[model samples]
Target: MPTKTLRIPTTDGPADAFAAFPDDGKRHPGVLMYSDAFGRRPVLERMATELAGHGYYVLLPNLYHRHGPAPVTELPEYIGEEVRPAVLARLMPVLEAHTADRVLSDADAYLGFLTAQPEVCAGPVAVTGYCIGTLYALNTAAARPDAVAAVAGFHPGFVVTDAPDSPHRLIPGLAAEVHLGIAEGDVTPEIIGELTRALDAVGLGHTCEVYPGTVHGFTMADTDAFSAAGLKIHWDRLLSLLDRALARD
Candidate 1:
């Protein structure tokens, strides 16, 4: 796979992003990968490269580009449980600033850049996200129903909140096949039933599961909550969704 640093022109400005694609000259399906609140980092880049090797052009953009390029706020080389709260403190404000309006605006710009690429095939693409990043993926799928074919969210949050604008509300308009890997501690029988009922009501295609024994950040390698099994499960579910939704000749 070949990886490169690039810029996605947004309504805000040129947002710095990373891209990974197969070395072969042929174009492939496009996958937009959104990072956790940690924003872009080596872990995200490696994840993008691994996915690109599987025959898709994966693009990882800075979700907090409004403040600045990724690492929007400096982060520790390793984020352990002891420092997790402080990190979330610094990031929450920036993440909070990304209102739904801003997310939808940025999605249009990012999707335009992705679909316009010579290395990307002509068709609906996929969007994969982790942690709070899942909200971005959901918004993109809803706002650009024509351009997004699948959505994979790992340890997702805020999808079924009481807020009128919760991400689940966006499901009715989405054409994407959805997969949501919910962290164990984040859900109860009630939450699961609520979320599932919403999906069923819309007649949307989806797979929703609570990853057993995994905490909120189970898929993040640098966190104490990281679970090897959960990470592998995410990869399995995510790739399957992409393979089926973005299948091509």
Candidate 2:
């Protein structure tokens, strides 16, 4: 895989990002991968490369570029349960500051930049997210239904909310096939049913299921909540969703 550090021009400023793609010199499908609340890091880069190796152009951007580059706040190498609370204490303000308007702005810039890359083939792309990025991914897919063919999220957070503009409410606008691999207890059965109903109302192909024996952030290897088995299930569902949605005639 060939990876390059790049900057995406957003309404706020230039957001630091990176792209991973095959070295075969042929254009490939594009995937916009949103990092978890921890933001971009080695693990995310590795994930992007792994997805790239499967024959797609993967772009990972720093969600907190407005505050500064990735790791906007210093992070411990291993986020054990004891250290996670402290980390969240420091990050909550930053995460909360990223309002819906900012998300929409960044989504436009990110999608525009991804599709414009020479190595990315023309047509709709896929968006995948982890943790809090799930909200972002859903927002992006809803905002750009025509530009996105697939949307997948792992251990998602804040996607189903009571707010009038909650992500679930936006499902009617989405054209992408959707799959959500939830960590056990990360979401309530009631909310999951609500999300399913919204997706069904829109008549789109979708699934929202909780991964057995996993907790929030189960797909992140650097987190104490990481579950190897859960991660495997995530990749399986994610790849298949992408394959079915992005397949060309």
Candidate 3:
């Protein structure tokens, strides 16, 4: 696989991103990969490379570009109890600033850039995200039903929030396969049930599962809650969803 650093022109500003794809010189399906609130870092780069190894052209953008370029703030090598609060303090404002409107705008630019790449095949693409990135992933899929074929969100925060513009509210617009991996400790059973009901109401093909005993950020190798077993489960579900959504084309 080969990886490259790239920039995308967005309505708000130029967004920095990373791309990884197979070296075969053959065009592959495009996939928009969103990074967690921690922003783009080594872990995200590794994940993008891993996805590209599966034969898709993976694009990982710096979602917090509105505030600053990635590594927006220095992330600790490891996110333990003592360092978690400080990191969140610096990250909260950027996360809050990523309103639905901003996400939709970036989505347009991102999807456009990905599809235009020489290594990407034509047709609908897929979107996948982790943690806070999951909200944007869901919104992007809904906003571009014609171009996004599937969406997968893992350990997402604010999925069941009371906010008027919560990502779950856009489910009706999604014309894609959806998969959600909820951390057991992130939300109550009732919340998950309500989200599932919303998905059903929209007639979207989807699956929602709770990864047992895992807390938020279970798939992030740098987090204290990281679970190797749970991460494996997440990868299995994500790759399966991508294969069904992008591989066919």
The lDDT of each candidate is: 0.88, 0.92, 0.90
In candidate 2, what are the lDDT values of residues 1-249, reduced to their tens digit? Answer: 899999999989999998999999899899999999989999899999999999999999999999998889989988899899899899999999999899999999999999999988889999999988999999999999989999999998888888999889999999999999998898899999999999999899999989999999998999988899998999899889988888532
Question: Which stretch of 10 consecutive residues in model 2 shows the poorest summed lDDT?
Answer: 240-249
Candidate 3 achieves a global lDDT of 0.90
Measured with C-alpha atoms, the lDDT of residue 125 in candidate 3 is 97
Candidate 2 local Cα displacement, residue 151, angstroms = 0.4
Query: Sort by TM-score, best first: what order?
Result: 2, 1, 3
Candidates ranked, most accurate by lDDT first? 2, 3, 1
RMSD of each: 1.1, 1.1, 1.2
Best by lDDT: 2
Model 3, position 185, has a per-residue lDDT of 76
Taking the tens digit of each residue's C-alpha lDDT, what string does model 3 give over 180-228? 9989878788888888999899888799999988989998998888999
